[model samples]
Target: MQRTAAPRQIAESLTELWSPRIIGELDDSYVKVAKVHGTLGWHSHDNEDELFFILKGQLRLEMAAETVTLSEGEMFVVPKGVQHNPVAEAECLILLIERKTTLHTGNVVTEHTRSLAEQLRSV
Candidate 1:
């Protein structure tokens, strides 16, 4: 069976904050959708770059050098080894494309951080 991925609809259905639901996969990456509010701590992936696409609301990707603001329909790529924190003033719906081995919050493990096992759980 060929299943289609509806990012916006899946995002709107999400009830948890900063918890990403896997929707699809391409080669070595996993396509994930998440509803986020506030911040997700500061961290970095030493070996993988992360791509973020905003599906609704707004987001601020704060890196050590500068902060990049993303609105609906916008996307940004956080290069590998750059420390960053994702913050949202209002609730946000987003799609994340990351490597299969990428950690939820990278090296920083906080209460909000979701493990790979948790991220892999059925939504």
Candidate 2:
């Protein structure tokens, strides 16, 4: 198996504002690191659940029913078919877990969704 340093650092070292790097992948699942700021569009995945782990800074997940804020070392799970939007006031690093076939924004295709596929890379 291939091993490397923590996924958190991989995000922190990135110079881009909203780019992601694939740290690892196992069968149907993958681990990715991203640097986020501002607000992401509301979207949902029809076939996959998503897990977000905060490695540094803070993030907020807003759903139709409620909004959850995550600090460093915290995590939250977004079930499949539930629409949610992710936001960050300041730059934050996050680790995302989801199935390989999972689309970034499900059926709500946007410019953001266009970058999702390219962001995925073999570890």
Candidate 3:
């Protein structure tokens, strides 16, 4: 089947906060969308980098050394092994590009941590 996904729409339609839904795949990567607010725990991917694109609202990426803010249409890539925490003051829509093996919350398991099976389910 041939289909196209509207990332923003998919993200906006999400009913769960901090839960990411898989929308598409590219080679070894997965394209995902999530509706988020508040802050996600600090975590790091030991092997794969992660990309975050702001579809709506803003994101504050706090790192071990510095903090970066991204608004709508902005994107940033967090390098592998770099500890980061994503925070949003209000509800935000985000698109995530990451390797299929990348864990949603990296090595840390918290209340917000979601399993691959959970993330792969229909939104």
C-alpha local distance difference test of each model: 0.93, 0.84, 0.95
Off by over 4 Å in 2: 114-117, 121-123
Q: Give residue 71's lDDT in candidate 1 (0 to 100).
A: 99
Weakest 10 consecutive residues of candidate 2 by summed lDDT: 114-123
Error of 1 at 74 (Å): 0.6
lDDT of 2 by residue, 1-91 (tens): 8977888778888776556677888788978888889887899998899999999999999999899999999999999989999999999
Please state the error at residue 109 of candidate 3 in Å. Answer: 0.3
Query: Candidate 1 lDDT (Cα, whole model)?
Result: 0.93
TM-score of 1: 0.96
Residue pairs of candidate 3 with colliding backbone atoms: none
The 10-residue segment with the lowest total lDDT in model 1: 1-10
Off by over 4 Å in 3: none
Pick the TM-score winner.
3
lDDT of 1 by residue, 1-123 (tens): 559658999888888899998888899999999999999999999999999999999999999899999999999999999999999999999999999999999888898898877777777
